[model samples]
Target: MKKQMKILDAQDKELMTVRKIEREGNALIIRGKIFGAMPMVAKLTPAEARAAFSLLDMKTILFLLSFLFRR
Candidate 1:
């Protein structure tokens, strides 16, 4: 049996079906297994991806920060 996962890109685009997901310290390693071939592994952090696509609005930014940091 295999596990299924969704792979998202930097632009919030659904890239492909994630074949596997692994953790290396604080980063996530994603491997795509589509088209019967092994795709390249992409390593990223939640904060890094969010920062890369962060919005400019101060209020929205604050809201997002609060949401992310909330326990």
Candidate 2:
């Protein structure tokens, strides 16, 4: 699956543009550009992914779930 999205700040300013996100083996790869110019790439392993997600509070998780279950 291919998804192109723009990450915006609270003021609606574009912070980053996500060009692609994909899974490679057990890792998640994110390719994007910061400030619409600088190239950035991140690879998150399963352990790292879990650890990162663990930082989310219950309220945030519920808010995210709302989007997931949206029609």
Candidate 3:
């Protein structure tokens, strides 16, 4: 699976940049672009990436639960 995000400048310019963070086989792929040019990609460990996601999910779930239960 892959997740993507875009970075924008003050003028809301695309900045020719996109972040493609994905997992393929057993490796995590991190990609980025700058000024609509200069593409770069990197590989990361699954353990490292998933660890942050796990915490993020937990926080999201807690926030949702509290929101739903708020009076």
Candidate 4:
């Protein structure tokens, strides 16, 4: 299965994706892109990873964000 997931901007544009996920003990090393233009990396705890994946994809994530901003 592919862990890579696409990320889009606020304007509904393809920004990047979750290219890599590396697990080092209790930490998850994530790598992807920003604004679909540049590279990005982060280290998250098991709990943080759960929260991140709770939404599934960028489309849904962006939708929820937009909805929140509209209010």
Candidate 5:
């Protein structure tokens, strides 16, 4: 399953378009484009994923959870 998402800048202009998200082996891969031209790929290991999530505060976490649940 592929879920598409967008990243907007402060002016609400699209900076990145997340084209696909998938799991390969033990890593999570995020494929996207930066500034509409540069291709970008990020791989997150299990430990990296946990560390990344740990950076989010309670309010942001709650907002994301609410957004997902509302869908």
Candidate 6:
């Protein structure tokens, strides 16, 4: 069995498929298409994802957020 996850854009379109994801490892590798066209591959580390993505709540996520803001 192959473990995979779908990555969707803001408009709900399929952006990419996360074919291989190892959070505890050094990098997260993805294989999919762009704009439903050309094939593409990307590598992102945990550190990069944490700094660039605000929606991620991964293992080492920095919770700079405060509860007071969630009203």
User: What C-alpha lDDT values do all the predictions have?
Assistant: 0.76, 0.91, 0.75, 0.81, 0.91, 0.68
What digit string (tens of lDDT, one per residue) describes model 4 on residues 1-71?
A: 86678877799788777889888789988899876668999889979868878857888877877885685
lDDT for 10 in candidate 6 is 91
lDDT of the structure predicted as candidate 1: 0.76
- If scored against the real structure, what TM-score would every candidate get? 0.46, 0.78, 0.41, 0.50, 0.76, 0.43
Clashes of 2: 0
lDDT of 1 by residue, 1-65 (tens): 78876657798666678877899898999888654465667889989878767755787767888
Q: Model 2, range 1-71, lDDT digits (tens) per residue? A: 66789999999999999998899999989999999999999898999979979999999889998986788
Residue 65 C-alpha lDDT in model 2:
84
- Runs off by more than 4 Å, candidate 3: 1-5, 9-16, 19-24, 54-71
The segments of candidate 1 whose C-alpha lies over 4 angstroms from its true place after superposition are: 6-15, 34-38, 52-71
Error of 6 at 53 (Å): 5.8
Number of backbone collisions per candidate: 0, 0, 1, 1, 0, 0
Q: Least lDDT summed over 10 consecutive residues: which range in candidate 1?
A: 33-42
Q: Which lDDT tens digits does candidate 5 get at residues 1-71?
A: 66679999999999998998899999989999998899999898999989989999999998988896684
Q: Which candidate gets the maximum TM-score versus the true structure?
A: 2
- Report the lDDT of model 4 for residue 25: 88
Clashing pairs in 5: none
Residue-wise C-alpha lDDT for candidate 6, range 1-71, written one tens digit per residue: 77766779899988776566444468887676666677777888878878787766664344445534656
What is the lDDT for 7 in model 4?
70
Model 6: per-residue Cα lDDT at residue 37 = 70
**Candidate 4 Cα RMSD after full superposition onto the native fold (Å):** 8.6
